[model samples]
Target: MSSKTGLLVITNPKQIGLVLSSVQQKVSKILYIQLLNALSDSASGVHTKIFSSIPKYSKEINGIYTQAARHCKHLDVRVLLSGMKHNLTKIKTQNPIDIVIFDKVFSQTEIDSFLSGKISTLTNNYKILTLNNTSEQNSEELVPEVSSEEEKRTFKHGVIGGTFDRLHIAHKLLLSELALRTDSKVTIGITDENMIQSKVLHELIQDLSTRIENVRNFISDICPDLQYDIVPISDPFGPSIVDPTMDMLIVSRETLRGGHKVNEVRDSKNLPKLYIHSVELIDEPERDPAEEVKISSSTMRMRLLGTLLKPVEINKNIPSKPYVIGLTGGIASGKSGVSHWLQELGGLIIDADKIAHGIYKCGKPCYDLLIQKFGEDIVGKDGEIDRKKLGAIVFKDRNELEKLNNTVWPEMLTEILKIVRNATEDVVVVDAAILLQAEWQHYCHEVWTTLVPKEEAVKRLVERNQLSEEQALLRIQAQPTNSSYAAAANVVFCTLWHKEYTRQQVQRAWNLLRERMCEDVLANCKNC
Candidate 1:
């Protein structure tokens, strides 16, 4: 009897050739390959190009498939494109599959789902094989470059603390050093949700359980023999301050001061000061020379957010009904008042900020991506995005704010364009504070910017938002200057003067906008 094997190739384009070759040697007869294409679902809205055709695959995947088809002529191969909702019954019934192969390790739930009904009854008869499809480029072993001279010393117990958001090379290096230096065991204190609120991209920080698991995994992968304890810490001093059993504390050079703070707290409690060992920060040779600062979780989050800078090129063939004007200004610069004045002038105003808020709501396209890029802490109990919580994270840091803009700007632009195309109005004003920063000038026929002096803007923010002078200054400083806005503006409205003066400026700009709109309509009609 010819033995048949059911191969479920959950592999990428690069690994398809190797997977087919390996499977051919194992199975003599029919090879059922269930190619998992994530683009089948609407959830993969970003990847619309991948699932538009039959036997859905990218150009690269198609090339691989063609090559595999030519090479594996002896083997009867049937390719089935699967989405999240997989069909297991039809494949088993038709082929009498004796063994199932998975390119990637499936979760217990997936395993259970795949091996349900009669297949579960005959446990020993059928076999499952998991193939590692990870490329050698990504699987390059990280050999520690740090000097191991001091790592010879052993301690009874050691404690280390950090946010450990995404376990990067630096994090792995730190954990490895701690494990090697410590004798019996090491205790790791991962910063909790409450504690990480002040951090840069705090919303992007992983949950306590995930962070702990990551730390545990790194420790296990590096030094499997080393006993370690991973705990969530609400404060800087988790168990280090209270626990007298810990003999030493390990920390990076940047966090060396924190180690001392722990010692101080221990000293105040009449406990002996723990020996502090500060590990030198590992250099990220992969990063650009300008960005070669200390390897940190903040930098990692920033890098992740940086990937979203360039959005997918969307269809720009919008209707000529609405002549869009991009309006922008600094904080407390009376840009909202300018927008209100424009609205009164019979222009349909589209608030990009409000649109952004709507897009951030639960079940929205940008919502889950935002949660993945930021974190769940930014989401409220009502399942809506907590703008105040989000603002708290981005407003303080310029880079963090830019990261946020990078993530949201593309989605916001796409939405704004969609709205503009469907509108019946002759004129539309897109009021966005980050209009210039987001490079939304492409969508508008003309750009208008409102300006106010730094000092006056600060004073208004303090009075309006009930914030202290320092807090108000921070908010003002975080935004682009009036000069920056003026550079991008076709019409610059100085809002420092009286309401009448601002209105006069708007009235003159409105007259010019009307003339331009007429010209645009005529141009579109001629083309049509």
Candidate 2:
């Protein structure tokens, strides 16, 4: 196998026996089974049980994503199916398909017909590998039975709609069913703009172009002969309301009402009513127990917690050993819990809030400046700045809050930098709630931001801090939104669920960080 680029052809998905039980032993070893089994089982379910029990990657197989990596020391080659989430940067063609491993044996003519000009150009130099061996039996004793659930059906022109973010099993089941049922054309109206605003973690949804590209790619994979019309629609009625040519509307139980609504609108226009086919949304057992049993994009976004989201960046000026991590999040978003974990993992914690507390003491420079800006009355009779009194003066007025931040933030930054310069530990954690607002992310190697949804934050603030729900909500709203933090952060952490789940994410993130650091160190020493 050439790690740089080479195709692996497994002629029949059934040849793999639909097995992935050895998953814990070696992840890479199960790729064949996971990939092939998914293709094998995707055919039978009339949108119901087909993909319900299959590995997550089966749903993940929208395109020819392959790596012919064997005996490659530097590469781990693990495509662990974690919540439909992968590096978003790769959508920019950073990881173009070097190898395409397919289960079907194609005649040379059929293969030539399906290969796009771009794909052919990409692997034009490589040989078309057919790794078929006809030695095995035709008996059921030797090979497991393929699922008859992938039974095919057909419609002339069908339509479906969804956000399709981080496409998972449920999406694949619906799309595969549509592909199976449609004989001539498939029209997909992927939600975008205001239509997707109601989705959980909608900010993290893949862009319109990315979503459309993936849907098109998947349909092409399932049925290359059909003409596909994919569009970004802001409303529920894309072309279905007016398109008289449409024959059917593919929908899940949740979306069955929308299909009826489509027919209602069609009736008003005197257009022929398109038939509505409903499939049960796949109930995936692999998802987080804290999330809905029905697999969803929200769950996928949750799984990205405590993971390095952006690529590793090396500043030529900064030394690599004591990798500084800037951690921040909104109020009651479990930011402190994550910081404590990092401290336990050997990171020297630079508590920015504590620094602010120290600098707000009576004699501190920030204390003097804050009194000059707001009033001497902002300080307590005990000769220190009373946070409640100061908060009363600042929180009510935007200008006063700006003044307060302007006075304290620079002082906090100075103390944080001082500690960073003198730290002796191999890791430094800058725990700043205002890390982004203060522009302090520039000091660290990676910005790890935490989040708990606004509702959770409100509940925590109301119960723990004795604030009213309205007050808690206002406090949360005052801070940067989760999407804003995600945009700037290199890593994201969330403690919305139980602490054990949070631990798993943090542990994974730390392990990966150590590996990355080791690689950086090795690369630097290679020249020596």
Candidate 3:
């Protein structure tokens, strides 16, 4: 079904949870919830308090994810909430809402007045679905549940902390609760630096700026008038432990302990203890049994498998029959391991090292050039260049290595292209170690890179090659950094964990590449 942008209206704020069933069935790209009675006063009112009212309703709908299970996993969780009394025109101006849904409490006349430009800015051209009937009277049946004193209360300032990666529904619910209770300011401490070091698939997490921007955007969408001071935090307790002005702390079940710790630190500082409010963990019933019970950024990052992470630029000069994936990484960074996975997944592995080795043999194109450049003394006793002896000569000098690369790389590239152009496999992996360094990505469809932490790469080299720490360090520093590989890559893999994780990353890349190739075929057919 085509995506529709929808707006849900609830006359009684207490019944917000009652419409999760309806929401689950909605294919809307985004669903905005607007509360009619958020402002108690029509003429004289503090309008910002409506944000707090949303969290009360959010609690009612918290079970929706459990109900939808994995079906609503991709449901846009940046749910926008606003006070409907004054913001109807403002919302319509911001979004092109396709449908308006009302709870059973709204009268037909009330909806009519809303559509006829009395309060709602929605045009009559828009489809309107109402749960209310004209024949039904609300004399006694439609009384909403009375909100508790806590629900009715609002605070001066509220603080919350999280990684906020991918910004899933759980993150949204927590942020909504923070905006709900806090009146003036919402201080968000986004976990980064040393804090993100422990997360699984942490490399895939959006950067600190992106997370902060998304959080700020979500809050601005739901409660635009309120102030949000976003900061990158390295420690467990950031501004919450230090900001004496904060009066409330919003936390999930996971961070409930951290919230109390914030209070404990505040007590020591002689600052007012924040009122700690903890929300339940969101249930993700379809997730792997091994993962946590809640919807998480790490799970979302894992789900990025078999999906396009970056755009691929089609090189028209190159033939598309065997789609080439140029794979590269630093020394001991598991490029070979990833290549093995791709080969098993049906990609024709064109090993650049093998091609270069072939060129170094007798009668091959680079055999004479190797002797001419590095001297005939480098030749082995068996009429071929001795690789170990040549390595000793070139390894001591960067300029000598450059001279050798300049002599051999062109011949190797020509041989690789010849193999690729004639291959029958639907996908081709040009496993080149210096793909980017030699400026070889120009011929391929897209590049896949592998990387590991610099220190981790050194550790792997020491353990696997039985090299000393100093020797491993020298070899690692000789190659390109992770940043360089990532910059040149369309997809990235890390084998720092078990081989199973490496297989998953490679499998995801293979599946997505197949899908992309199929689409390319269809496009070519249409063009014909």
Candidate 4:
């Protein structure tokens, strides 16, 4: 019923457990079987051919095929045993089966044949899935087990491998769903160039460290219990599958057939069979009805090249690319004015003051922390912070100020780092008056500053804020001195009384920043 609700896949064997781990279902309960080719007396099952000459290989192949045929007489195994192996249809008729799964080593010709319908008997009702093609005789297809509810309750341990290029939300979604189904820990083994051929694509996005970091962050954020690593995955079957302690081998449809070849090797070694699990077909986003067309990294590159007129919709759910710019200015300077300009320019402004305000609003953690460190005087009557009172206490005493910085800096940095880590915006501005003081310089690539003479700044404060000249001076003194911030400035603007001139200066700086960002993107692409 329902054409078997669980997935039926034929591909490289290595991805079986990954598929099972993805779906979070058990291997045995879901028809977890491997597709294999055995040398029978030629389709008629008359006499044993090449395999018969080798007693062990002959027995194992015969046994597995015999078992599969007894239950599935309609199944057809392509003649992979012959040196001149051809498509399943190319061979003379042998066994009459409901579905014939053709097995060919990984090869471009074989892939073309299957996809082109040259390999017959395929319909919407029956499908063929495969792994990366290598040589003509290297193709392998492994059938996945149909995952079921009963298998999920029991804890299962599995190991799987992959290249895992550019981690995305789809991967997290697939992993989380699998974890939900089984009480199991999925240990991921990733492949590197040493174990396999390098995957070369035009849009090389991230470096190895960035890719691994993305994978680790995804695992920690979404499925902390799942184990993962960058490891070798060359053997047709992973080393874990042969180990007695390991249970099932997890994989995707693309890797199922590789498992069959592994079985052939295992038969030679007399190793016990390892259960296989395959992941269900994840419909490509291109096929989505809501999305006019699916988008991929390849598609993004096409858009960048202007080969494609419209941008494909890349999955927005995953974290966006990192973008950050450092904005700093001295006491009574026009940093806030510059920050506002950056906002108008469509830059994400992460002001330290805003974070502090949030902490004060979140209440307890910051409130309790302040009171405990500075005594009850810091708390106000209306259940809000009296900024003047708090400022007075800390501004006067260096130890008090240091203590305040110590108390607030950790929490502030934590929040800022989280935002920076997940930034997807084209450009983000880190508006920190005390950026140099707070050690935020290391996090930024460029610094923009606003400069005004101490006397002029003081005059502006008195006139605009209605503060007395002496009060303005005190506020100015409270900020990090101008010389301290100058050391870190990559671009500096002299704030003038004329609003038009100041605006022009800001607009020029923004245009320069945009140019720099585009250059950096282009540089990264070239390196990739």
The 0-to-1 C-alpha lDDT of every candidate, in the order given, reads 0.66, 0.65, 0.72, 0.50
Predicted model with the maximum TM-score: 3
lDDT of 1 by residue, 102-187 (tens): 66666756665555621322225777777775453422222233434443455778888888887764565566456545667789
Query: For candidate 3, lDDT tens digit of each residue in 24-79?
Result: 46645666665544434332211223333434555544543344344454456344
TM-score of each predicted structure versus truth = 0.38, 0.76, 0.78, 0.39
Question: RMSD to native for every prediction?
Answer: 21.2, 8.7, 5.5, 21.7
RMSD of 2: 8.7
Residues 312-343, candidate 2, lDDT per residue (tens digit)?
67766666657899999999989899888888
Clashes of each: 1, 8, 1, 36
Could you give candidate 4's per-residue lDDT for residues 240-351 as a string of tens digits?
5465544555555666887666556666777765566554323333322322132233222222210121222333443335556678876667778878887898888899
- Runs of candidate 1 exceeding 4 Å displacement: 1-321, 519-528
Winner on lDDT (3 vs 4): 3
